[model samples]
Target: MIAFLKGRLVEKTPTDIIIECNGVGYQVHISLHSYSLIKDSESILVYTYLQIKEDAHTLYGFVEKLERELFKLLISVSGIGGNTARNMLSYVTPKDLMQAIASNDIKTIQSIKGIGLKTAQRVVIDLQEKVQKMYGLEDLSTSVYNTNAEEALSALEVLGFVRKATEKVVKKIVDQQPDATVEQIIKLALKSL
Candidate 1:
């Protein structure tokens, strides 16, 4: 079990990275969240999960241990695989994913590119209890109204902006100002986009 890797970063992209440990170079698949965290570093320590298959062995890396743990939990579901789990992490932060699973937010899970309604439901049903147990549902009650964010995202999409890119920008804006209005978010997102 290659638990983690600490070495000089040889190469990096949105989906993967190459790290030189000793004299060996390891290609590690990573999600966007991890990439954003470790992209600027020349040297990094990434927590990894090794997936073994009949044809290949792959290493998935995470910037945080909790994200790696969430990836493991995601892949443990019946219809989820390594790529799908990685996509889920790429689409949303680990904390948001945990919250979605705990709150049974099938819509959010289904919004990820490769996931469908049934798979999203399965993910929620299979992991809801575990997620609630692992990360107690304490903050579930304080739901922030994200209608402004949703409206801003919709407006951006209607104006021909890609949802994926617009989402990142809108999320950043919302994170920085949780109580921002729809127009404020859209204006801010427009500037960033």
Candidate 2:
């Protein structure tokens, strides 16, 4: 099994990138999030999974081993496949994905493209315990990074911020921020509270 390939990126398509390693150009299919991380970088290391069939072989690449493992886990469900799994990974960050699964937030998982009630239910049924164990989310995430806008807003309300103030603060921060981090959230919450 090829664990990963460290190579120079030679070409990138909408869905795949070619990495030149040891005088070989390896084509790797990547997710939108991975593509954002790659951004045409020459030197890149991609953890990989090679799928072979009677007619052809395909290689899928991930930014990290955990992502590769998550992809495989998604495909292992009875009705889920590689494409659906990749699509799920493309839009949602792994942390959010794990949080949703561990919290039994089926609506969040079902919102992903190509995932329906059946697939979402299967995901919750098949992998809920595993994700909870892996992420230590038995308490449903106390990690600093776990707070999204909605969660942070709720916390601020309990901390004496008015409902209107909380909503305004969350809205202002979320509107201007491209990325959500715990520090940023706390700072914003403190400002409002």
Give each prediction's root-mean-square deviation over alpha carbons.
9.5, 6.9
- TM-score of candidate 2 against the unseen true structure: 0.70
Candidate 1 at 129: error in angstroms?
0.5
Off by over 4 Å in 1: 142-193
Q: Model 2, 86: alpha-carbon shift in Å? A: 0.7
Clashing pairs in 2: none
Which tens-of-lDDT digit does each residue in 1-193 have in candidate 2?
7889898989876578899999999998888777777766658888998877687787889987778888888888898766778788887877778778876778889999888899899998898888888657753444433357667777777777777767656655664673666457758669655
Best by TM-score: 1
- Writing each residue's lDDT as its tens digit, candidate 1 over 1-193 gives 9999999999999999999999899999999999989966778899999999999999999999999999999999997999999999999999999988986778889999989999999998899888888876632322232577778888999999999898778766776787888899989888898
Give candidate 1's whole-model lDDT. 0.88
